[model samples]
Target chain A: MRTLYHLALSPQSRLIRLVLGEKRMEVHLRAEPVWERRDEFLAINPAGEVPVLVEDDGSTIAGSQAIAEYLEECDDTIPLLPGTIADRAEIRRLVSWFDRKFDREVTDLLVGEKVMKRFLGIGEPSSSAIRAGHANLQIHLAYIAWLAERRTWLAGDKFSLADLAAAAHLSCVDYLGDVPWDHAPEAKEWYARVKSRPAFRSLLADAVPGLRPVGHYADLDF
Target chain B: MRTLYHLALSPQSRLIRLVLGEKRMEVHLRAEPVWERRDEFLAINPAGEVPVLVEDDGSTIAGSQAIAEYLEECDDTIPLLPGTIADRAEIRRLVSWFDRKFDREVTDLLVGEKVMKRFLGIGEPSSSAIRAGHANLQIHLAYIAWLAERRTWLAGDKFSLADLAAAAHLSCVDYLGDVPWDHAPEAKEWYARVKSRPAFRSLLADAVPGLRPVGHYADLDF
Candidate 1:
């Protein structure tokens, strides 16, 4: 069996988990507190990040994008990336948008300050940072709405890693009950379709011991 | 001819430039002030970032990783990524290491505070941020030395995009003369090898009008 070392609220980890499920690959999940700088985890991934996947053959794959591409190479069953070079580029561009742009502008500010800080004992959450996160979230949601209104999925007609990546980040923030779903109904509708997928079940069931997700987080109609 | 929208100091842009050069692809470089959020540039990449590549057919690829993968898919002549699935994973993992981890901890701090701030006219650079960038850089250099000491190349036997990504970030910072080369001899040796490649010529020759690079910036012997 393969194993995934991950953090519950981590968007990166969430993204990988979603990818694995989409690929229909079963993986034993272990919650790793990376901030502790565990030597074992560090040995697995020198970068000390979560969502490091170790195969039954003892081969290890680190980094979400690396793992995502590796899975695509290993199996083409559910094809998260669309065909054609141009379409693939668009999918990857959106993936980077969510992974890098959204992560920096939104997720880090919100989750880094609100959730991870407490877990790592890194002091109180900054109100200003949270405020900025919400502001950025609005802009990103609008962007998502813009895409959803036009394309069937975030990337195109096909359900791709672009949708997975965007949903993964949104899921983490939504868990904190921070997403302005009402303000961006089109984006909300798009997310609802994604959330109904079989891959998202495990994520909806995810619970962080002391911290609770939003009330409507698991609700399909929310 | 292909076109690359980039900023000379951007690590992501530098990575793409190196990859393009390594693949023997000719590109006309256009310096883009991304912070200005030029509508024309925004149309190319909504993320408002640089290193967006436009093909002769007008097909566009945004994001460094996307562009790199696109290049690999399009042409395998130089084959910056290795042969096997495992090898490719390792290369990409290291590429992510440099692009995300190294950039966040080092490049963004140093370059963001120094060069980008100047270009954006966003006030003075913070001394503390620069101090932290240098501090984080030492650890990264030591890690590079560790890898170089053990492997024939950063990701394994063949020179891959892993090396290009790492070297790209280092080169950008090195331009500002912030790299402490004396502390990591093995890393410097590896960089020297990368620096001597013909593909690196364009990057080495890069010069920003008002802010000049260090005297040894383009010198392969240094």
Candidate 2:
């Protein structure tokens, strides 16, 4: 069996898990405390980050995008990046948007401050960052709504890594009850569709000890 | 001809330029002041970052990795991401190392502070950040030396995108005379080899107005 070193709340980790689930690949999950910077984990991934995938054959692939691309190449049965070269580029663009931009503006502010800090003992969450996160979330949600209104999926007519990357980040924020779904109805509708996917089941079920998810986090009707 | 909207000092933009140069692709370069947040630029890439590529057909691709991957897919003549899927994964891992981790730890602190802040008029640079960048650069340089000493190139036997991405970031810092090349002779040797390549010529010639590069920045034999 393949193994994945991940954190419960890590949007990158959740993105991979969703991708694996979508591809129907089975993987044993091991929560990695990246802050501790364990020697073995560092040996596998010198960056000390999550979403490192180790094949049963002992080959290791670190970094979420690397793992996602490797998986897409190795298994084309359920192509997450399905399209022409240009279309695939669009999907990747959105993937980078969510993974990098959205993460920096929203997830890092909310999840990083509110949750990860508590676990890592990095000091109390900053009210200013939380306020900024809320402000930024509205912008991102509006963008999502814009995309959702304009296309069948986030990238185009088909589901791709873009949707997964976005939903992954949004899901993490949703877990913390940071998302104001009512403000962006179109984005909420699109997310509800993504949330109802079978691949998203495990994520909604995720419980980071001592931090209970919001009441509607696991609700399909949400 | 394809056009690349970029900032001369941006590591991401430089990486793409190097890749394009390596592939023998000609592109009309347009320096975009991203801080100005031009509305037309935002229409193409809502994220509003540079290194956005527009094909002759008017189709566009944003983000460095997206453009790099798209170019790789469209043209296989001189493959930057060469070898097996696992091999490519390793290359991407290193690309992420420099593009994300190293950028955060070193390039962003050095070039971002010493140069970008001056251009953007974002107040004075922090001495503490410059100090931290120098400290982190040693660790990254040592890591580069470790990898260079073992492999023929940063990723493996072949010159790959990993080398380009790392060199792109280092070159920007090198332009500002922030890289402590003396501390890591092995990494310096590797960088010297990359610097001598014809693909690196344009980057060496890049001159940002109002600020001159270090004297050794354009020196192939440095």
Candidate 3:
């Protein structure tokens, strides 16, 4: 069996888990304390980040985006990218938007301050950082609402990696109950559809030590 | 000709430019002041970042990684990525290394502080940030040297996107005269080879209006 080294609350790791689940691929998951910079783990990925996937063939794939693209190529039963080049570009664009932009503006601010700090014993969370994270969340939620109102999915008609990427970040934040879902009903409607998917089940079941998920985290109807 | 919306000093934009040059693709370059949040630009890329390519066929590709992947798929003549899946994963991982990790730890600190802050009129550059960037650069340079000593190219035998991505970021910092080449002689040698490529000519000749390249910026034998 393949093995995945990951942090439970990492959005990047969550994105891969969702992709793997959507494809019905099975892998043994190992929790990696990336902060410790373990020499053995560093041998696999010099960046010292999760999630890293080790194939049965002995090949290792590091980084979420790299793993996602690799999986899409290896398996075609469930395509995460669009068929056409133009449409695929749109999907990739949205994936970058959520993974990079949204993560920087919101997830890193909130999760970096709240969860990661605690895990690493990095001291108290900054009030300004949390406030900024919440403030940025509103803008992103509105953007999500805007996209949901126009397209069937975040990128287009197909539920591509863009949707998964966006949801992955949101799921991490949602675990902390940071998302103001009610502030963007259209986005929430779209998310509800995504949440109802079987791939999301594992993520919803994720419970970090000393950090409890929100009440509606696993609620399908929420 | 296709069009590329970019900033002259942006590493992400530079990576796309290098890829375009490698493919021998002609493109109209449009300098975008993303700080202004231009309405027209935002329509093309909600992320409002550079290196957005608009095709002659009216298809638009945003984000450097997305654009690079799209270009590779669309044009295979000068393949910047290796053929095998595992090889490709290694290439992608290194690309992510330079683009995400290096950019965050080094380029962003230097370029973001010195150039972008001035462009956006975001106040004076922090001395501490510049010191931090220089400190990080030494670590990355050593890593680059380590890889160069082992492989023909950063990824493997083939000169892949990994090389281009690393060069793109280093070029920006080099332009700022921040890279201490003597510290990592092997890495410097590798960079010289990447710089000598015909595709690197445009980047070598790049001169921002108020910001000039370093003395050896366009030097092939540097």
Candidate 4:
């Protein structure tokens, strides 16, 4: 058995958890409040970011993508990533988009707009930034919808890490009711497939104390 | 021959250019003004970002990382990236550090203070953000120097993608005389080695019209 040190509410942590759950490997989920910065946790990861995995060999893996790749290599039986070179590139691209662009333009924006004010002690939300974030989301969501319509999964027919990355960020946005699911049936369906899996149960149950959940936060149908 | 859509001033685009040069692959370099969008550029990359490589097969690869991976697949002799899984993960983590973390903290601040103000017709710059960016750079360069002292290259012996990622963003920051090169001699030596390459030649010549070049902009040994 391995151990995963991560924040309960983080999409990346949950994504990694889902992958491990799918593989039926036991991973002790240890909560690490990265923002609070425990000294031991900082030593494990100088970046102080979560989704850090301690493997059986005592080697530590930080960064969700790195951890996911390490796991895929540890056991290739249930490949969460693609095999061929081109397939791998495509999967990496999609994973990066959700991790970078979607995370920046969508997830980052939503979190900053709807969440960061209370967290940062920055007086009241910046309405201009929030509006800009929403506008950016509109564009990103459209592009995602277009991508979803063309493929069964995000990168291709097989379920890959790309889907997990997307679901992770989208899940957070969804929790805030910030995602425009009605406008993107394709994206919605894609998420539904990811959501229905038993592995997603832990992710869906997560809650942050002061930040109240949206009306449909726990509703499976929503 | 592949065609690379690049902005000469952009380090990400320059890194791809460097790789292409190292591989001796003939790539038609199209110097695009990314800020002012064009239809053709949009057709190639939905994100409207630079370093889009249009492969000979007419398939386009967007994202510097994705484009770099696609190019690596085409040719491996030069080996711009690591081969082993663990090493590659390390390389990718470092690459992400500069591309994401540095971008958000250092580059964004400097660019906002130096570049964005000019772009938006905002006079002068925010003195506070520039000071903050400088303070942040002091810390980042120290880390780079620390890492350089321990390894032959950023990730390890091989000059992997991590080098290009660091140089790309740093080069942009350097253009504004933001890099405290004298503060980190090891990092300075690394930069000199990287900048001296034929691939970096084009990058060194970039000039943002209204902004005067940093006094030592193209001084190779400096």
DockQ of each candidate relative to the true complex: 0.86, 0.91, 0.80, 0.47
- Please provide, for model 3 over B18-129, each residue's C-alpha lDDT reduced to its tens digit, 9 standing for 90 to 100: 9999899998999999999999998988888998999998778999989999999889889988778888888999898988899899998999999999988989999999
List candidate 2 stretches off by more than 4 Å. none
**Model 1 CAPRI quality:** high
In terms of lDDT, the poorest run of 10 residues in model 4 chain A is A113-122
Candidate 4 on A1-222: residue-level lDDT in tens? 689997655777877888897777888989886657779987877778878888778767788877777678778788877667777777877877878777777666677566755655656776777777778777877776788899888888888888888888888877787777788787777888888877788777878777767887666687
Model 2 CAPRI quality:
high
Scored against the true structure, residue A77 in model 1 reaches a CA lDDT of: 82
Give model 1's TM-score for chain A to 2 decimal places: 0.99
Q: Chain B TM-score in candidate 1, rounded to 2 decimals?
A: 0.98
Q: Write the per-residue lDDT of candidate 2 for residues A24-70, one digit (tens) a residue.
A: 99999999999899999999999999989999999999999999999
Q: Residue A165 in model 4: shift from native, Å?
A: 1.6
Which residue ranges in model 4 land beyond 4 Å of their true spot? A116-123, B116-124, B210-212
Residue A171, candidate 2: C-alpha displacement in angstroms: 0.5
TM-score order of candidates, top first: 2, 1, 3, 4
- Deviation in Å, model 1, residue A79 alpha carbon: 1.0
Better of 1 and 4 by DockQ: 1
Error of 1 at A205 (Å): 0.4
Scored by Cα lDDT, where does model 1 land? 0.93
DockQ of 4: 0.47
Each prediction's total of clashing residue pairs, residues at least 3 apart in sequence or on different chains, is 0, 0, 0, 0
Model 2 over residues B147-190: C-alpha lDDT tens digits?
99999999999999999999999999999988889999999999
| Residue A45, model 3: Cα distance from true site in angstroms | 0.7
